[model samples]
Target: MNSKTVAELLSQDVTLQDVTVKGWVRTFRANRFIALNDGSTINNIQCVVDFENFDEALLKRVTTGAAIHITGELVESQGKGQSVEIVVKTLEILGDSDPETYPIQPKKHSFEFLRENAHLRTRTNTFSAVMRLRSSLSFAIHKYFNENGFYYMHTPIVTASDAEGAGETFKVTNLDIKNPPLNEDGSVNYKEDFFGKETNLTVSGQLEAESYAMSLGKVYTFGPTFRAENSNTTRHLSEFWMIEPEVAFMDLAGNMDLAEDFMKSVLSYILDNNRDDLEFLDKRLLDEDKTKPQAERSDMSLIEKIKFVVDNNFKRVSYTEAIDILRNCKPNKKKKFKYIIEEWGADLQSEHERFLVEKHFKCPVILFDYPANIKAFYMRLNEDGKTVRAMDILFPGIGEMVGGSQREERLDVLKEKMKALDISEEELWWYLDLRKYGTAVHSGFGLGFERLVMFATGMGNIRDVIPYPRTPQNAEF
Candidate 1:
């Protein structure tokens, strides 16, 4: 039995006897050559067959997308690209894919069409490469946190506390949708529901992770987070994974250092281990760039940009400074931005963020100390009582890749902020207890995993990066 994947077999320096590989046939060409892949790597193993030795009926079943097991002798290839090939001795058809009915043809397909056929999209080289890179990035994230004395904590998926009140949340209830229990005010009476109180899919795990971080000293959560926003842009997803790391005794500066180091470590890992996949994606992006207008295309290739991020130090600027740069910038002055940056307390938009990262700095930028009104209530308030110890890491082409801050530790201040925001004290009693008892300066940040995948893969759409993207009004498998 050949337990080795196509990747393992192709990496050999010497030939092997009775070697077998099992995979889906990517293509069967010239009635002799077979391109087989098992999702182990981006490259396919060239399997050469002698048409005279195999029965005509058996060979007919070796169509594209067919699952097959081949027992053969691994030998040096007479081929041009690959180093080795398998000369088949015995072949068995495990499953057959009808070329007439299969959705994935051996040709270029639009990303929109691929997204609609997402279940079979991975069979394509582009998607396969993106998913493989996604898996590698996931592994690197956990590996980094684990090796750096951080505990891998699991936060609840269903919670009463909306994380930072960041956005709308999806309700989790057993009540019938048609006739939900209602209160005197006509609101859903969640008290009669399964949890006996209102609960929804968590928007962010940072708050819960913070409780653990306070105790564990350093901890991280890599899990699914949902948003109920009705956005249908290339940037937003109704459901996505988040990488959040909360640490005790860490302030804004320390938080910035941690975010930069963590991002670099993961990108460097992919560059070292997943170079082939990256190269494939890099080429894919360049080919895509050829079709776009000169201004719309990216100046740097995918791998080059990843390397640049890994090699350089992120430019850290205060919100005030960033505002100054944007207020007098060419885009704002010319009214190019749809939302103009007119004042200090105004929220920064995606256009503004991309400007700082791509045009102004020509590198990744970290903007810190945002206005208190614009930031979450948990962020530590500055002595000026205007801005918070908050920060956002901006990437080229992608705005706000990471958002986090040093949390408010003083019990009175936290309570005051919550009160001003009209958040009930009774609802977050436990969150307040953390401050009342053992509160210390702690900081954390949340990065959308899909956004990272999109950035890493140079995929234009968020839906293309995730396996089964959950967007508004689109949840088909």
Candidate 2:
């Protein structure tokens, strides 16, 4: 009486005398063979319909994308591609999709076209596998933290401070744009605003998570973060998810250890549990590579790339040492790099990161002790006075998988850094109180949830990983 999923029926040890199944028709071939899928797995189950016993009208309605229910006997599949199929004794059309107007057919569709029809893209094999892996990775993250004595803390979505100081926060306000209240000098008067001051969606939860870490000992925040940047690149997203973990009494070395272990654990979980989806995505990427030039093809497959990260240890290099390598590397000397590494204090771009991971080091790399002027204000300053204890974990194809640092715990030094950066003492008085009360060496790191998904799924664009992407000039479902 109850319907069994395609996955359950396929995994059965014996043939069923009677089984009920519900799914949408992927294709109806020769008016006898029907390929049905229920979004349970990448493969579909064949339904052999007895066309003579069924009404001609009902058979006609079994079009592509039509929802159908069947009561049948499960038997060994006579076909070559499948192991088992349902011998349909009765069929009912739950929903009819017109063959003339159905956008998703049983043929290959371009990723660009799929993005336009984003609502139904998951019906295909690629997006469904990608989203399934996304769900699995999310669970793995929570599992790792919970089992390791970490508290899951929910940070506020709307806050008064820009944690990253990147000046890219999306403003949250309740004021009239045309005629807002103005001050004597014509500046916008926040006295009548909702929060009575300027507020924006939080860009990071690190600052708030640090407060909790001081008392809780170990805390992490996994939630949505927003940015108002207008850049439309493959890596940039206006709204994305971030994972930040803060630990008390941890130094820069321990921070790197946590990050590396966390990443390896999550990636390994997917490989062990979500092998079907991973295999599907791996083949999809390999097929996609056939369309590219051979020179640009990847030397390793998708699964191989993932296993490589999980098996090897990340190479830890100082920022100064990396700068030296890049300054004299063939790419920089020959002007092949878009932004050549020419100086000590220059920021490293994505190209430089990939060069280190893919060509030079040939493994994941953690570059630390970066120049203080290039990092955030909360990072601890080194005794050298020019660098901080910040670190970034760079991947081969996906550069900068994680960014974190040992936080400044000294009240006087933190206050000095805040003043130099124009960060007001009054705004972060509560944060400073953590240092004043019991200042200890604390460290944490943040990984963009979408970036991890991008690497794991071999998806080129960051937007494809998230369900509904919010980007500049586009917010379509």
Candidate 3:
């Protein structure tokens, strides 16, 4: 079979048959072996060449990152280490990469260095694996949504609504930042802004996606989302991606089920489709301990872990129960949290979220029904008058991978909640019009795309997964 995939070529029986392969040299060993890896997979296949047949001068010109094509006969290596090998008959240099200029080498380079060379970092084994997994998971997301009859909706990137509630937004202005139009009260006049009014990059597509879900039955949006938040923490990024699915006839329970199933599906697809890449990552970059602390290990062994999670059902719990358990924990017996979590009235911080998922639940936990006062104004109010219909799916290593809620369908209730939250009603006229025209009980949740990658690949930072990360004060590409 004619295939372009390196993974496929490695596994298939091509031994003693003429085949062509092209890739950059990851490593060269023993003056007779070339460790070749294409962007196709993480694992580099060993090509054993006889120095007697090939000119040493030509081989010497080929450095670490040089692109070359090999006409070879694949052979089963009974050698001590590798399973298979390729005996190269003809080696041709397609492109020569300068050894001094190529930033990536056989030696270990810092993550910060890789960030500076974001354009070239993809050639590295770790990044190649990450990008492959990323591409596979993205396809899996579409597959899961499409198979379930969910329409893939595209949401606008430039929006007037700042839905994240983070309050940190990048202003899209045509006027000069030094001196811009201002009202008599000295506030920036938004009326004259671009789009002929106030506008900013969208933080979430949930609001826009909701409008389509109400009519389309079930719809989802997957795209680039921007946040102007100034937080420089590893978990925070200015520009990221999100996958949000809204179901018109769904409630909080249905939303939870979708989140769990969606996550499992993505994990399962990566494990199945990218098994060789993941296996190489596990052997080279992942920690030696089966249960090692999360680190930047090249051998992430993600495929095995993903399969294990897919085979198991996620644990579910309520927010109220989690609070009670945290309060009674032996470690917290004498210690009070800074923003103390009381039984149904407080917000859950990352620490609390981490403690619950990593320590108590010991697996992926879907926690729901948080108090209305701490949640966004869009959430539906519960009968108890204290909590809203919201849920957050927390995983063992990453906390709050998904956050969503059942939107308030009642016009008056929504307006009341908006008023209490001190959100300007005038800014949300179009959003209100949806309820006036034809409102249906709908639910949706925003899955932080980077968080999903981090969880799936065991990458530590939000910055690592995204190319050219746009964190506060660090937009250098």
Candidate 4:
């Protein structure tokens, strides 16, 4: 017989006919009921077994994490929570899982514990829901951009340049560490490497996306990005996905509008299509928050926060204005902030950003015109020469959900900025050619895909949202 997923079976009326289902057993209760899930949905379909007819050894194999195939008849469930269930006529153990050794069991496990067993964490309810929402949001991003006259460009995962200029890049090389090709200056010869030059995993696709945007009018890149920063925080990941959209002839204001609209559209799509998963996550977050202090708990539920963002306009503020607020804010005033905002050029830390978005603005905030020294060289320089036309969209919990800016179109200014920042002119000649020939004002922003998933799923850690989180000293999975 054709196999039907648990989600499909649960959604329809009981047919009172035979149905074949294949899935991993979530739990085997009293050797009679098996909670089966096949990753179709968060909810599991209950499969009741006729233990009297089954062999004792066969029934013993129906432990948690075991893969099984069951031929059964769909009928109305007597259980309180589920509406329907399967009455199994015959059961076949496709794969047996010993409860003594299976890492994931039918119990609550810490996110840290789950991180160690990243390969099997999806068997749990939380990770599965998060991954599902992540998938939905990914689709929504492409759909939103495609429907809005934007071309999806596939950017290279490996590149010769560091787009962010952070210097924390994972070097990609195929050289013998013990005895590598050396140069006359006693330096490792990168010319002998695979690409004939020093290369690394791309830090961002924005540079490449900008080139396409200039000619294509608008383009977006969604792909993996790498960073070698050794920060072991819940929010930092060594390798993650980024969604960057660059548009030609767009200024700072237009860029802000595009980002806000894009975020709302994607969030709305998830709310509509993945309500079940969101609901599950929402409840999970609420339950998790009960153990925390009252002030530490979220002001609104997960769904409420998402809906608030979707329905409300993002409060726009200038970096100068944000600086004033941060300096005068209670945290800075009381010296509670780890990094105090004392002056105009100081970069805003996570605490400061949270205060602006959560405490002061009480909504999503867009802070623009950041100090030039604190921003990237690509951002357009302002008249004052002190700040650049950069914008960061800050969410309530997530510090900076999106970072973008209006690109400096003037060739002379761009070259000067690049030289001042010590960026190689010859290496980026192709990028410079874009500005030299026909560079019109272009703008774009990068949204960390994992951070977006964390926001949508109410998952606290960046590690939990990504399947195999690549972090410093932790690449087991």
lDDT of 2 by residue, 1-477 (tens): 999998888887788679999999999999999999898877789999988899998899999999999999999989898889999999999999999988889899988788888898888989989998999999999999999999999999999999988889888889998999999999999888999999999999999999999999999999999999998998989999999999999999999999999999999999998898899899988998999999789878899999989999999999999999999999899999999888999999999999999999998999999999999999999999999999999998877899999999999999999999999999899999999998899999999999999999999999899988889998986
Candidates, ranked, lDDT: 2, 4, 1, 3
lDDT per residue (tens digit) for residues 1-477 in model 4? 889988899898757888999999998898888999999999999999888989998998899999999998899998888988999999999998988999998888988899889999999999999999999999999999999999999999889999989999999998998999999999999999999999999999999999999999999999999999989998999999999999999999999999999999999999899989999999988998998999789988999989978988999999999999999988899999999888888988888998998889888999999989989999999999888999999987778899999999999999999999999998899999999888799999999999999999888888989889899998885
RMSD of each: 1.4, 1.2, 3.1, 1.3
The runs of at least 3 residues in candidate 2 whose Cα sits more than 4 Å from the true structure, single-residue gaps closed, are: none
- CA displacement after TM-score superposition, residue 57 of candidate 4 (Å): 2.6
RMSD of 4: 1.3
* Weakest 10 consecutive residues of candidate 3 by summed lDDT: 294-303
Q: Where's the lowest-lDDT run of ten residues in candidate 4? A: 6-15
- Best of the two (1, 3) by lDDT: 1
Model 3 TM-score relative to the real fold: 0.91
Q: What clash count does candidate 4 reach?
A: 0
- Against the true structure, candidate 2 reaches a TM-score of 0.98
Q: How many pairs of residues in model 1 come into backbone collision?
A: 0
Task: Kindly report which residue pairs in candidate 2 clash with one another.
Answer: none
Clashes of each: 0, 0, 8, 0
| Per-residue lDDT over 107-195 for candidate 1, one digit per residue giving the tens place of the 0 to 100 score | 88989999889999999999999999999999999999989999998899999988767649998999999999999999999889999
- Expressed as tens digits, the lDDT of each residue in 1-477 for candidate 3 is 242446667777656776778888988888888988888767678888889998988999668999998878777875755667788888999899888888998877878889889888888877777777788888999999999999998999888888867677777779778998999999988778768787888888998988898888899999998877668887988899999999998998898899889888888888778876677666544444445655422222455556545766767888888889877875467565555554556677777787776567666778888878788989999998888899998765456889999999999998998887778789888888879988888999998888888777767777778878887778685
